[model samples]
Target: MHTRDPHGCCYLLYSAVVPESRPAIPRPMERKILIEAGHRCAIPTCRATPVEIAHIDPWAKVLEHRPENLIALCPTCHTRYDRHEIDRQSMLAYKRQLQQLQNDSGHPTQPLIKSPYMISTLVIVDEHGIQVPNPFKLSEGSHNFECMATYVDGSSASYDPYWTCPLLDRRGKFILWAVLGRQRRSSVAISASMKHERYTELACWVFPPDGSERPPFNPCSAIGFDYSYFDSPTDE
Candidate 1:
């Protein structure tokens, strides 16, 4: 059967000859038409908020962007169609009726449904700029450390070098050890729970000279990388 929809698109109901075992039904252009129809249920007497898209012309029978052949429907109407309560002829009638209603009301714009993607922040980098395939664990609590600082003698000017200190993690929890070099000779060790809600930045400095070396680290790959609580709402 051939028909011309309100959008002036010609379509043929030729799916009757297609095999029932076709992998899946196709409705590529149906969604765009539904979006153009406003995201409201197309059925009369229902007026339910639409959460699904339906083809006025069964996708199995036809394929084309005939605005008169697309409808925005709530899940309930969709389920009714699946349950065999709504036949093809009635559905087409409803589709035309809905199109007329939309034309009369002068409202054809639909709400834009934004679909977002997900991303992870736990990335590890080494000196060569390569990422580690395996994950590493961090220890909690104050890590005691020793650094060489000059000890003052009787003259008060004579100094013996070395000092012991503590470092704190992002959560204020003590992180025992973090490797800064392959030999592990120099490292930033933290101890105790973090006092701040979140640490925006991290930098290290060597003593005595006061500013000889300072390195900034990313908090995501650091101790606060366990973001199990930050769920992406778009995740299926």
Candidate 2:
């Protein structure tokens, strides 16, 4: 019988076996992936935040955590991909879209104004009271139209109006007032006038109640009208 040292035998067996575990993504790399995806789900339509770091290629096959091979996906999307509801090609496409959006650096794009009850347009106003055209159409009506002001460091005050009045002019102008809200924040008075039976002319004025000096420009002002409302019913 051959006598064997148990410790030496175990060491030799351990050294002969190859490690099969995949490497985990570093914290820094994970953060970079999340940031590149705008902290939102990689799927453009999902927009869910607090995403998970997912591998484009299965770690079982690639065993790498490179940025190009990683993406940020919501738990739902990740599960969908794992379950084969979404194919690998779609996952890679979403990742590419996110990368392309990130490459458009310098001056971030503003969020588009959306409404569920009314069709409307948006105009951006600067600090010098200069109005810039940002025409958009909304299919719904909403009580509030909140957006980032160009002149303000943070998000500007919510553009919620307390009163809405329909003007008697043929131009179809409506006036909105925000006087009953909190103090310090300026009250916005808006007059949205329709023109040429197609477009709208919006005039926004800001009034500060605290006796403070007002900025030379208005940040965001928008005016739009639905042309469908003006369409006459035709006979079949």
Candidate 3:
């Protein structure tokens, strides 16, 4: 169950290499990791890049790319992580710090809603085939029945999204939403759709109360959040 590195470090090697082909992290999810670390290594001391996403929990066991379990790290830090030089608790702490940083820096006015714990973006690639890698905050109202989302561009006002169809897990805990929004002063409405040649499936990430994680029900159901323009906006 334990493998020792040459430096006498021990790690759970059995849960290391995934036997089957591992699934890829959604583009949006991966971008979330990079953005958290400012596109550098998540290690506080070594903030170097090009960065790669590291699974806080081993992929071999979890087999899911849940955002809670992913982090951005440079190649060296990644190697150190794989070699057990870095540990899980540290990674988890890093995630907590980064999330707090994002919240403090982006939205100074905190929501008065009970479901304020949620901080995720629901991305659906538009018909035009482009998406924004940046994540805009989605502020929820009571019961999350109706909500407004804000997407910021370098110039102009924030894009407002009137979101609905929040997807819940078996426990009736809402984890994802079907979103609709448009750029400031735009006429057209935009929505996200995933149509495969065979079938389209929907699932939600289940977050445990204990800050633990479960692998996603459908690992391949991952779709990215898009901040890019849906269609060329008409000049106001």
Candidate 4:
């Protein structure tokens, strides 16, 4: 059978029976698929989580773990695809759409890592509950923070005088744990694992810096960035 790689189309070989126990997918490749899906179901409308990496072409047919043939799906969505409720064309479209988004976010495609690094980057798809992840703590100091769900790379988003707290999406997903410094003067240092990496282009709330009363939404606007690249944080 045939499949498409990032460069172009390629071919896959079929096996009569699916391996009862396929080797655990290599961690780096698994991470690639997770990042591509923004760690959620690839279905644009049903982007539920906790996600599972799935084969676009059934493993029973292809009999190999190729990055091009993989996608991320929630339990329900995975079941739907397996049951043929979701078609191959639609699934391929989802992969293409997300890859385009990551490229548009400015990172382009990166090579898999021998080691993973964490940094301060986030994407808030919906505003609701706020939470923080571990390797994080607050001492006594200020921090400069930005709302990067829409305007990653530091927009003129409002951050008030001073605040330090965890932030979660409305879906209760742990998107980020922000201990932001005061607005305008983002000079507060923060503490987080420098190895954590995050990127997403999903549109959320990124208030304008101009102090405008209303900011129209732009669905295509990019989100998240390597905050450490510019706003490297420090401990109090």
Best by TM-score: 2
lDDT of each: 0.40, 0.50, 0.47, 0.51
Encode model 3's per-residue lDDT on 1-236: one tens digit a residue.
Answer: 88899999989855555367886888888888888889987665456779899888888778888988888888887887787765666666666766656775556643322211221232322333233222421222111111222111111112223222334567967543332211112112333423211112221221222233321111111222332233335488
lDDT of 1 by residue, 1-236 (tens): 89999999999877555454533324566655565546666554354675576665566676444556666777887777766666766566556554444454466643211100001122233333344322222234533222221111111111111121224676886432232321222334433333413222222222211223221111122223222233324456
Best by lDDT: 4
Query: What local lDDT does model 1 show for residue 140?
Result: 41
TM-score of 4: 0.37
Q: Runs in model 3 with CA error above 4 Å?
A: 1-20, 104-236
* Model 2: lDDT of residue 18: 60
Candidate 4 segments whose C-alpha is farther than 4 A from its true place = 1-20, 104-236
Ranking 3 against 4 by lDDT, winner: 4
Angstrom error at residue 136, model 1:
79
For candidate 2, the TM-score is 0.39
Candidate 3 lDDT trough over 10 residues, lowest sum: 137-146
In candidate 2 the C-alpha lDDT for residue 62 amounts to 75
Question: What lDDT does candidate 2 reach at residue 89?
Answer: 74
lDDT of 4 by residue, 1-236 (tens): 77878989687968686457878899999999899878988766566889999999988788889888899989987887888766777677667666766675556654321110111123322122232222223233332233322122122222212222335667876433233322322223343334432322212222332234221221212233334442555677
